[model samples]
Target: MGKIIISTNVSLDGVVQDPDGQEGFRLGGWFGQFGGKDLEAWAKISLEEAMGTEALLLGRRSDEWFAERWQSRSGEWADRLNSLPKYVVSSNLEQPRWSNSTPLTGDVVNEVSKLKQELDGDIVVYASYQLGRTLIEHDLVDELRLVVFPVVLGAGERLFGETSDKKPLRLVHARTIGDGLAFLTYQPVRDA
Candidate 1:
């Protein structure tokens, strides 16, 4: 069975939106605001991890957002991501602009569970805040990889919301990047 990993970039206060200045949130652009070798190192590490991914699981909005940007890029990361199989969880989006994409139009939990059984490699969920929350709520997320930056936006989209139940997570790995960024890997504790 394949594991579903929820990987995200979060602020000090846990906000995950517009860190790259893409969204209209003028308060963002927090990442790389202060230039340093750490930021470059973190980027290299993230890109390396992304390249190892075999498939992508995304929400409709995130799918559209990334498809518009990463699909057009000619870098190694873009090439790998665009070539990998993509499963999008969406009720409204009938088709994705990127190639090798399939819509998860059925029950989210059931569909993902089936996919986990069928796939032979890792399934990564990137930047799908709401979808990540849903996967967490449904106990579908097997692991979480959080890249935390050292800045507070005070307000924006957060990784955890009200509906997120308290679940035990064990820290498996930790790394501090050069730019005051911390990469934390966590795995949910299975019930005994």
Candidate 2:
């Protein structure tokens, strides 16, 4: 069975919006400030993660964003991303234009639940805040991988929203990915 993993790049204050400045959010592109060894570390980690990912699960906005940027690029990273089976949660996108993409528009939780049981590797969720929150709320996320940056965007959307349930996470690993960056992995502690 594949594990549902939520991988996010967040600010010190938990802001996960607009790391590349594509979104019109005022605090967009906050993560672009890193350079030098930090950039190299980020790239290395991303490549490692991609190698282990079986498929990509994205929200509509992220699906569009990734397709627009990656479709025109060619490299090992881009090749891996373009070739992966991508699934998006969107009611409006009847047929996704992205290559090897599928739309999951009905009963997201149920659909993803089935996906988790059927697949053999990892289903990684990248920058899908709405979808991530829903998964978190329902306790469907098996692992949370956070690349925490140094800066803090006080006004942007956060990783965790207002949830009534108390989700306890056990830190499996923590290390410095680069200067002013921390890579942390947490496994959800489910009630048995």
Best by lDDT: 2
Local accuracy of candidate 1 as per-residue lDDT tens digits, 161-184: 766457789999998877488889
Give the poorly placed runs of model 1, Cα more than 4 Å off. 34-36
lDDT of 1: 0.85
Write down the TM-score for model 2: 0.96
The alpha-carbon lDDT assigned to residue 157 of candidate 1 equals: 86
* Span of ten consecutive residues with least summed lDDT in model 1: 30-39
Model 2 agreement with the true structure over 53-108: per-residue lDDT tens digits: 99999999889888888888889898998999998988778987667999998898
Alpha carbon lDDT of residue 56, candidate 1? Answer: 92
Which residue pairs in model 2 clash with each other?
A: none
